[model samples]
Target: MRSVRRTLRTLQGDLARDIALVLLADGIVGVSFGAITVSAGLPVWLPMLLSVLAFAGASQFLFVGIIAAGGNPVAAVLAGLLVNARHVPFGFAVGDVLGRGWRRWAGIHLMIDETVAFALAQREAERRRAAYWACGVGLFVCWNLGVVLGAVAGTVVSDTAALGLDAAFPAVLLALVLPSLRDKTTGAAALVGVAVALVATPVLPAGLPVLLALLALPIAFVLRGRLDEPAHVREEASCPSR
Candidate 1:
């Protein structure tokens, strides 16, 4: 159909470039995750499996770190789940773009940070759908492939952190959120989030601090609501009756 062709063209053009950048970032971070996981004595196939199944970069790192530290597997799973709790809200925010029926099943696997950010950046429904799928599937493939490559190379590259690969994941996230920082409310929320995370980092166990940072969200929303109410009341009071 003509609609399908137009969609495909848009995907191959604008979406492809954005997805390519995401792919490269994910690939590098995936490689770092793979190498670090292997260096911690995990089998190469383990990380490759995680890349396909688990697929969340932060949670995967936390899982691997906990295991490597001789922490309980149960604890690792709990921590990973806690860190990934943000996806619950993310699923709600982009539910429309997730498609219907069996397609929703596929979309669930793709519901990570990058895909969510890219989708939200779009103003139009169709473009948001396209961006989500393109970034999600592309990053998934690239991440897995990089995992395989890095797992193999782990034997040779014992010092993955020395190569500065540790910064890749946060860098990608920063890039995604930077645009939204231009807005005052978003910027304020970000500052609050950073402050909360930093303060909690020393007191809480690895992943818990990030989860704690999410407390800023409700606070920001409530504050914004209160600020809007007075202005709304003032505007109504200023209006003259006919």
Candidate 2:
């Protein structure tokens, strides 16, 4: 009991900051999603469920777009899964901080990009937990609020096309992916995914290109090992001299 209280106390500030930031960021993005959802002719509740349950902005956007584009539900779900597969690695990276048992499960479920980034930024385990929960809950509330607001207002808003709501998803995705291009390998992988998607666009359905992008993962893994070997060898050689 004492330990729990201590942990909670340590988390207070980080929790406040993280929740605030996440709410702000997610609220903006949620507006985009809500706008698109309304324009796509989906039921208002659909966006609400998506925002509340899915809680993954990119995946929710992709799912709605795929469905609106006349794609199958299976295809839409698969595309969303492929797009979010990166979260699996992010979860692994933060596993240590997540602790074990129920807390671990909570941490994993809440391990979105913002939560992961904030938690990883913290040097202490306790701080990481606080940050994660703060962002996670903050994003959840703000995201759902935006979805509801957009859905309700969307019905009355005219000329969704004129508003260019359809472009929001791609623009947001590009923004999310662009910053992660830190190295040649990752850059090449992203380039290849885009190229593959473009080439497959005509041949495949709206959601299929996403799957093709996922297929590039194995190739990246192979390349990653080869890319790291030279650096590892150089470090080993230098260590012997010391």
Candidate that scores best on TM-score = 1
Clashing pairs in 1: none
lDDT of 1 at 228: 83
TM match of model 1 to true structure: 0.82
Lowest summed-lDDT stretch of 10 residues in model 2?
A: 168-177
Candidate 2's error at 146, in angstroms? 1.3
Candidate 2 residue 172 Cα shift, in angstroms, is 12
lDDT of 2 by residue, 53-131 (tens): 7778778988998999989999899988876877776777777777788877766667777777667666678887766
Candidate 1, residue 50: how far the Cα is off, in Å: 1.7
**Worst 10 contiguous positions by lDDT, candidate 1:** 1-10
Winning model by lDDT: 1
lDDT of 1 by residue, 1-242 (tens): 56446556667766678678768867877777788899889887889888899989888988989999999999999988888888988899999998789878998999998899888887788888888887887888888988888888885444557766667557767776788876666678878988988999988876667767677788768777877888788889888752
Off by over 4 Å in 2: 1-19, 155-242
**Alpha-carbon local distance difference test for all models:** 0.81, 0.72
